[model samples]
Structure formats: structure tokens, C-alpha cells
Target: MRFLSLAGWLTVVVATAAPPSVELQLQDEAKQLVVRVEGQPAMAYQFGDEFALPHFWPLRSPSEKLLTVQRPDPYPHHRSLWIADKVQMGDGPVVDFYHSWKNLRRPSKPADGFRHFIRHQRFSEMKTEGATALIEIELQWIVDDNRPLLDEHRKLRLVALGNGAYFFDLTWNLQPHEGDVKFLSDGVHYAWPYVRMHPQFSGEQGGVLTNDEGRRGQAGTNDQTARWIDYSNTVAGETEGLALFVYPDDTPPQWLTREYGTFGPRRAEKWSGTKFTLRAGESLHGRVGVFVHRGDAKSGRVAEHYRQYVEDKL
Candidate 1:
């Protein structure tokens, strides 16, 4: 007689399970989002056992626009990619995300070091206790390191987005705000269709973010004390991509300088721009949400959808 134990039968099925065809993402209204960008592929998030920063380190040079640079083995960005089940794949499009100084070719002071300059070399293991995927990031930062940057810790939660959009709930134990943190989108506009700040239309109308107190005719307090800004191009049907930042403790900061397609201090060579500092032993945190959509940031319909997202308290 031929018989099979239930456990053995289950193991057989598991071993023969089909490989994942495409990556997946969605939104979780429950948790506050820390990071979420539209249209990122699974290949973009590969790492070793823990999340490792690949050597590439999504970079942009002076002669060229923003692009992925492949240094030799120990590729920087490759180390950053999260590891899957050893699935080989081709390199995907370049998506620039700066959680540390690595993202910038030249940040403020380039040598003086950044505000509260946190030294982050490792990512906590991806742990799943209940229904959420949790990952904590440790940084080697020095408070009193700069006038505006105070040291702090950061935590991010990757929740399942049954749909095609991902919800990254990031909590920042921030280093105080050194210089103002915003975007320099002149050349960058070529890549991302929509880009804008919160309390402002997404990037569709081409509206830029400036610390123009004069424009605050009737706006609320800059709310510098830990608030968020969201940008997205949408995932499900069609929408706008998002760019937003929040500062807890209302960390004081200065405005950023402009570059062709880049945003940071000392773009060319002459340290030109405001320089804020984060005192030692201080902490701050914020959240950012990105949604890749199929439309512009200011379309009438898109505006309504954005309102819905805000109304839903996302």
C-alpha cells in the first residue's frame, strides 16, 4: 500500500511552488507612512540576509543627469537591495532615495560632514511578528555635530499593499534640522513628471517650494514640528507621484540652494546656501509617503484623489 504523511505531502507542494512573477505593493491607512514610491521593482530592493546597501549608491554626476553608478564589486546600491530567495534578475530603472549622505554626490560641507551626521552602516533584520513587516535602521550620527542636525534613530515598516502601491511607514528619531530639507527640481523634472511639497499641489503645476514667508498670506504655521508632505504618481489606476517630509519638534532649519537637477549643499564648489545645525543629544522624526500614479500632480481629478488621501488621513 502506498501512503504519504500529511507533512511530507505539504513539503512536496511547497518545494514545487511557482516563483513570484511580479512584485507587489499597496497602502495601509492604519499606520503612518514613512516611505513609499510608485513603480519600484522587487529587483530594486534586494539585499543579503539583512537589507544590504549595494555599492552603486544611486548617484548623479556633474556632466550627466541623475543615474545609477556601478563602482566595482561591493556595489554600494547592490548592498542596499534587500535579498529575496536568490532570484536572479536584471538591473531595473534608477530610483534615487537619500536616507543618508550616500545619496548625494556632494552634500553640505562635503567634508565638514552633514548635520547631526548619523553613521548608519547596518539595517535591522526584517521581522514579522503579526501582520506587519518591521525594519529598524541604526545610524552613526553625532549630535552637536552641527548647528542644525541633532542625532537620532529611524524606523520603517513595510506593510503589504495588496494593490500595486506600497506603504512605507517611517518614523524618524531625527537629528535636528540643520538646513531646510526640500528638493531642487529643475533638471529632475525630466525624470519625475509630478513633484511638489505638501500644502502645495503635487509637482504637476510646476510649483516650486520656497521658504517665502511672504507667500504665507493665510497658511498655517509651517508646522515645522514633525509634519509630513506626500507626493505620488499613483499605483492602482492613475495618479501623481509624491515627495513629502515631516519634522518633529519643529526642528529649525534654513532654505536649500538650487541645482540643475540636484538638491543639497555645495552643488558646484563655493559652499553657497543656508547651513542649519542639529545640536548634540537632540532627536527628531518625520514621515514621507510616495505613490506612483498615472497622471499629473494637479489635474482636477488628481487633486480630488489627493484630497481623498488626505481626508482618509493617509
Candidate 2:
């Protein structure tokens, strides 16, 4: 009996000392890559060809509460979390990959009529190191079925933050595959990557929007520049939120925030409402961090995390 009790105690001790872990699972049939932290589903990357473009949906809070909404009304093009922009390849017609469906001949049948899209060609890497999972993928900005306009290399790293929270880092590198690719996005209608929160966590539903400089709400933060922004709220008696952080060197001159649940950093002033071009060998690169935590910005130490992000600590 004494020996059995000692063995039971050792088992409990080992379990308590175990570190958090992250896992990536490819669900081919679903055309999604599911990310799990400590064995719980946290988010998914949807890349089915049937989709107008690749996007991440069902981004959940630490407690597994859905924090994002896909295809919300008023602007169905606003995917939960995605990257998009308008571009013209060489002298070709301007392609609105942001409002991608507009480039489709038959909007309802995406697989049949997509004239321009950000296509996920393949996942080049998927591996776990310590408590973090890394994913690297190849994508193409294609036009007219098979004409590739840009080649993209996307990298994502997810780290398991203890107590149910997590940190995600994303990098995008785009190189013109053909001739010059001109970015012709408007200042008002775009984000480097947008996050649309679930209705329950929207500002209209009691969520709070905060920026690094201490601004709050759409009126205060919209069209304003910031190093980082956070949206948080208490839903079902639990407080949780997510923060988007821009790299110090790549901080956009302005950000777009909406009380209806949409928020993100816009491109720099030089590129907004104007044209920026990348030559055939030139690449446009950007990086951002997402911190999903179990409390509001204050309690979640959003500022601290942002600092770590800039210092390569987070």
C-alpha cells in the first residue's frame, strides 16, 4: 500500500510539472488546418478552393469561446481574420482580391468562376518545437484561372501561453511573379489583415476597443495610428480578448477600427489611396502578432506582451 501511494503521488507531480503544448492537424477533407493548444481546438485556417480566398475563421478565446465571426452582414467580404488588397498585374485589369467575389463570374460558384484569388498552393512546413507549432505555406496570387501574378510565402507560429492563452505570429512575403504588381488599395476599405469579432463580443455588445496609446472605441481609435490594438469583453460571465500588434518598424500610419466588431492596421500612408509597385524580383513583406488572452487588455498585460513582441521575447 505504501509503494502504491508513492507511485500515485509521483504521477500527480509529473502531470503538474508538464509544460503546455501546441499541435497542428491537417484536415484534408475539410480543407482546413486546425490548431490545438493543450489538445483543445483554438483556431483553423480555411483554404478550400471553393472559398473566395484563404482566411482564418472561428478564432476562439482561451476558454474555447468563439471570438470571431465569418461573413457577417453589411460587409460579407469581411472574413473573420484575413489578408487582402487590390492589385493590378502589369497592364492587366485591376483585381480586387479584397472584395474577391466581385472578380468572380458566378459568385455563388466560387470553384467555377474565380477570376482572381489568393490561392494556397501547399504547406511547405508543419512542425512543433518545444511548446510552439510552426507552419509555412506557399500561395499564389492568381488571375484568369492559371496566370500567377504573385508568389507568396506565409509563415505562422503559434506558442502556447499558459493558463489557456496563446500567442500567434504571422508573416507574409509577396513577390511579383510576372512583371510589376501594383497595389491600388483605398485608404478606407482595407486592413493588412482584419479581425471581425463575434456579435457577443462586439463593442455594441459591451466589448472594449483599446489602443497602445490609451485610446478607446471606434471614435477614438479609428483612422489613428497605433503600435497595437485590443478588443475585449465579458461574455457568459467570462472575460477574454485578443490583441493585434504591429511590428515596430512596420507600424502602419493608421489603423481601422469599427464598433461593429471589425478592426486592424491599415497599410502605411504612402501606399493608401495611391499606387505602390513591387518589381518582378522585389518582395513586399509584413509581420503581425496576435495575443489571445483570458482577460481584458489591462489584466491581460497587453502592453507588456507588445513590448516582448517588439523585443523578440514573446
Query: lDDT tens digits, residues 69-138, model 2?
Result: 8889868888899988888987898998888778887768666767778899999999998789999999
TM-score of each: 0.37, 0.93
| Candidate 1: tens digits of C-alpha lDDT, residues 13-94 | 2334232122222223321112222223321222221221212122211111112222222223222111101100123212
Q: Model 1, clash count?
A: 77
Model 2, position 285: C-alpha lDDT score: 80
CA RMSD of all predictions? 15.7, 3.1
Error of 2 at 173 (Å): 0.6
After superposition, the stretches of candidate 2 with alpha carbons farther than 4 Å from their true spots are 1-17, 107-111, 250-252
The candidate that achieves the highest lDDT relative to the unseen native structure: 2
Each model's C-alpha lDDT? 0.29, 0.88
| True-structure lDDT of candidate 2 | 0.88
